[model samples]
Target chain A: MKWQIISSDQALYFHSWDNECVVYNSLSGDTHLLNLTASQILLKLQQSPTEAITLAKLVPPTDQSESHAEHELQIEHLLAELNALNLIEKCQSTINYNPPSCR
Target chain B: MNISTLTLSELGHRLKKAGMFLQTGTFITHLKTSIPSVAEGIRLLYADYPLVEHLDFADFHVSLTYPRNLRRWLKPQIQFLFDGKPPFKPLPADQAFPMLEWGLNWCVSSHANHYLIIHAAVIEKGGYAAVLPAPPGSGKSTLCAALVNRGWRLLSDELALIHIGDGRIVPLPRPISLKNQSIDIIQSYEPDAVISRKISDTMKGTVAHMKPPANSIIRANETAHAGWVIFPKYQSSVPAQLKKLSRSRAFIRIADNAFNYSLLGIKGFETLTGLVDASQCYDFTYSSLENAIETFSALEPPASSK
Candidate 1:
C-alpha cells in the first residue's frame, strides 16, 4: 500500500532542528513534535505517495542490529501510526502480506 | 503624572470615588476599590506607574469590594469585580490585594488577543529579550527577580505579549508574585527590594509580591526582539547546566504555554514559527542564583541577530 499526507503540502509546515522536526497542521490547528525518522517519512509522503518499501530506504542505519528487513518493518509501523493520528492516509491497497523475513 | 505624585490619602480617595486610569506598560486599567488592602497594594507597588487625570477608555475597569451577603462580615470575603460583574468567587478579605493583582493578570490574558501572550517571565538586555517559560515552582520568577536585581531589565513577570505583526516583545512589567519560601529567599537575595505583606491561607499558600523596579515601569514603551527561549527547572543539589534544546521541542513547549495560541489559529502558528526561527532554545537547571546569573551572563546570541 501507498501512504500520502492527508493535508495539502502547503498546510503542513515544517521547522526542523538537527534531528527533530515540528510540524504545524493548518487544517486541524495541531502541532506535532516528531523524530527524524517520522519527519523523513512525512516529508517523503508529502512529496508523493510512496510504498512502505520505498519509505524504508529513507532511514539510515543506526546500529548493526538495523538490517533492511528491520527498516521496512519500522517504516510500516510509523506509516500506520501517522495514519492513526490523521496526519497521513493510505492511498492504495496492496496485498495483506508480510515480507519473508517477518513471516 | 505617577501615583507617587498623589498622597496615600489622595490615592485611597481616588479609588473610593471615580477610578483612576493607571497605565502599566501598554494597557490602562480603571481601578476602583473600597477595600483598603487593594488600595494599599496599588500604592505600595504601582507608585511609579503613569496615571491619567482624564481618560475616555480603559482596557480593564476592575474593582474589589466585599459582597453584600453574610460572607462579607462572617468570614469577611472580598470579590473581584470586572466592570461591576464578578468573574471569580470571593476570597478571604486578607487576600483582597492578591486578588486584585490576579484579576488584572486575568484581564490581560483573557481579553488581549492583539499579541500572542505566553505565560512566562521576560527580561531584556543589550536589545534582546530572554523568554523563560515554566510552570509554577520552576523557579522562573526567582531567576527573573535575581536577573533584574543584578543588571537585566524586567520586561514582565507574568505575561509575555509578543506582537503578532513584528514579533517584538511588548513590555508588561508588573509586580512579581512570590510564593512559599521564595518570598523569604528574594528578601534575603536583594536587601533593597520592596515586597508586599505576606498573606497566608489562600489558594497559593503564603503569597507575597515583589514590587517591579521603577525603571522597568518607566521604560514600559520600549520593546525588545526575541532572542532566546529558555525553559528553566529548579533542581536541588544540581549543578547549574544550560543544555541546548531542539527548536522544535521549544516551539511545542511555547505554543503550549501560550494563552491564545488556539484562538489565533493560523496566525499563531506563523507567528510562533517566526519566533523560533530567531531564537536559540535551551533547558536550564540550577539551584544557586549566583551560579545561574553567571551562566546567563555568559550567554551570547549570534552577531547577525543583533
Candidate 2:
C-alpha cells in the first residue's frame, strides 16, 4: 500500500548529524531521534505519498551481504513502526483496497 | 542602588509595604512579604543584586504570606503567591525562603517562552558557555557551585536560557541550590562559600542556596555562545571521565531536559539544533569535583574563538 504523511500542513522539522537525525513533528509536539535508514525513509515519504518498494530503494543498504527479501522485510517492519507513531499512514486511495499491493 | 546598601530594617519595611524590587540578571522581581525570614534570606543572599526602582516595571510580582484562620495558629504555614494568586500549596512558615526561590523558578519556567529554558547549570570561561544539563541528584548544582568559585562565571545555576534568534545563552545568574549532603560537600569544597541556612524536611530534603559570586552578579547581562553541552553523572568512587556524545544524542537529551521545548514546538527544535551544531557535546561522569573541574578547565576553546 502507498503511504503518506498524516498532515502535510504540520511540517516535520529534521536535523541530521553523523548519520542520525532528530525529527520534530509540529502536530504532535513529539521529538524523535532516528537512525540513518529510518530518517531517509521519512524524508523520502515527506516529499509525497510513496510505495514501500520506493521507500526501500531510497534507504541505503547497511549490510552489503543482505538479500533483497530481507531488505524488503526490514522496510515493512520500519513502516509499521513509523505508522504506529502516526508519522505516516496508508494513502487514502489504498485504505479500503483488498490485498494491499505494497504489502 | 544595590540591595546591600539598605539596612535590614529598611529592607524589611520595604518588603512588608510597597515591595522590594530587585534585579537578578535579565529580570526584575517585585517581591512583597511580611514574613521576616524571607526578607532576611534576601538580605543575606541577594545583597549584591541591584535594587530596581519603584517606578520600573517588574517581570514578576510575588508574595509570601501566612495563611489566614485556624491553620495560621496550628501549623503557621506560608503560601507562595504570584500576581495575587497562590500557585503552590502552603508549606511550613520556616520554609518561606526556599518557597520563594521555587516559586520564582515556576514563574520563569512556565511563562518564559521567548527563550528555550533548559534545566541545566551554565557557566562561562574564555567567553564560551558550557551547559550542564543533568537530572536531579546528578550533583549538577554542586559541580556548578565549585566551578563558579574556581574562576568560572556562572550564567545560571538551574535554568540555561537560550535566545531563539541567535542561539546565544542569556545569563540568568542566581543562587546555586544544594540539597541534602551536597550542601555540606560544597562547604568543605569551598570554605568561603556563602550558602543559606539549611531548611530541612521540607520536600527536597535539606535545601540551601549558595550565594552567587560577586563577579557573576556584576556580569549578569553578558551573554555567551554555547560551546559545549555536557551531561554529567556523579557516581561515588568512579574515576572522572568524559565521553564524546553525538550531536543527535545531545539534541535529544537537551530537549528532554528543556522546560518548554515541546511548548515552543518547531522553534525549540531549530534553537536546539543550532546549539548542538555549535557545541562539542559530551557525557561526563565524575566522582571527584577536583578532577571534573580540572577536565573542564583544560578544555580547548571553540574553533571560532581561535
Candidate 3:
C-alpha cells in the first residue's frame, strides 16, 4: 500500500530538537511531539507518496542488526499510529499485486 | 500619582463613585467596590502602585458587590463583575480581595493575546530575570517571596508575560498569594513581611497575600531579558538540590504551564522555543527557604557597594 501526508502545510510548522520534533497542526490547533522515526516518516511522506515497504526502508533503523522483517513491521506500526493521529493517510493509488519475488 | 498618596477615605470614595484606575506594569485596571475590606486591601497592598488618572483606556473594568437579595444579609457573598457580567460564582464577601486578584489574572490571561503569559513567578537580579514556572503547591510563591525580600526584584508572582516579538518578560508585579501553612511559613521566615488579613475556610484552604516589595512596585515597568527557567518544588526534609533540565523538556514544561499557549497557536510554540533556547533550564527542589534563597542569589553576580 502507498501512503502520503494528509497535508503539506504541516512541514512549515515543524520544529525539532535531537530525536524529537514538535509539530503544530493548524487545522485542529493541536501540537504533537514526534520522535525522530515518526518525524522522518512524515518528512518522507511530505516529499512524495511512496509504497509502504519503501517508506519503511526510508526510516533509519536504530539498530543495524534488526532483520528486514522486523524493520517492515516497525514501519507498519508507525504508519498506523500516524494515521490515527490524522497526520498521514493511505494513498488512493492501487497496489501492484504482482509481487517481485525478491528485492 | 501613586495610591500611597491617597488617604484611605479618598481611596474608598474613588472606588465608590468614579472607580479608581490602578496601574500595574503594562495593564491599567479600573477597580470599583463598596466592600470596605477590598478597599483596605488595596490601601495596604497596592499603596505603591500608580493611580492612572485620565487614562484613555483600561484593560479591565471590574467590580465586587453584594447581590441584591436576601443572601446579601444572610451569609453575605460578593460577586465578581467584569464589564457588568459575572464569570464566576460568588464567594464569601471576605474573600473579595483575593477574588479581585484572581479576576485580574483571568482578565489578563484571557484577553492579553499579544503576550505569551506563563503561569510562573518571575524575579530579576543584576539585569538577569529568572522565570520560575511551577504548579500550585510547589512552594513557588514562598521561594519568590524569599528572593524578592532578599534584594532580587519581583517581576510577577503569578504571570510571566513574555513579549511575542522581542522575548523580553514584561513585569506584572502584584501581591504574592500564600496558602495553607505557607502563609505562616513566609510570615515567620521574614518577620517584617507585610501580609494581608488571612481569610480562612476558602476554596484554597486558608489564604493570605503578601504585599509586593515597594521596590518591585516602583520599578514595575522594567522589563528584563529571559535568563533562566527554573522549575522549583518544595519537598520537606530533602536537601536543597538543583539539577539541569534539558532545553527540550523545559520547553514542554513551560508550554504546559502557559496560560494561552494553545490560544496563540504556532506563535506560542515559537515564542516558547525561543525562550528555552535563550535560557539555562533547571529543576530545583528544596526543603528550606533559606537554602533556596541562597542558591538563587548565587545565580546573580556579586553586588558592588553603592
- Report DockQ per prediction, comma-separated: 0.64, 0.87, 0.42
Clashing pairs in 3: none
Model 2 bad stretches (over 4 Å)? A94-103, B304-306
lDDT of 1 by residue, B4-29 (tens): 88888888999999978878889999
User: Relative to the unseen true structure, what is the C-alpha lDDT of residue A74 in candidate 1, on a scale of 0 to 100?
Assistant: 84
Give per-model TM-scores.
0.94, 0.95, 0.91
Which candidate tops TM-score?
2
Ranking by TM-score, best first? 2, 1, 3
Task: Give the per-residue lDDT of model 2 (tens digit) for B111-203.
Answer: 889999999999999889999999999989999999998999999999999999999999988888999999999999999999999999979
Weakest lDDT window of 10 consecutive positions for candidate 1 chain B? B297-306
lDDT for model 1, on a 0 to 1 scale?
0.88
Better of 1 and 3 by DockQ: 1
Q: Which stretches of candidate 3 lie over 4 Å from their true place?
A: A8-12, A94-103, B300-306
TM-score, second chain, candidate 1 = 0.98
Worst 10 residues of 3 chain B by lDDT: B297-306
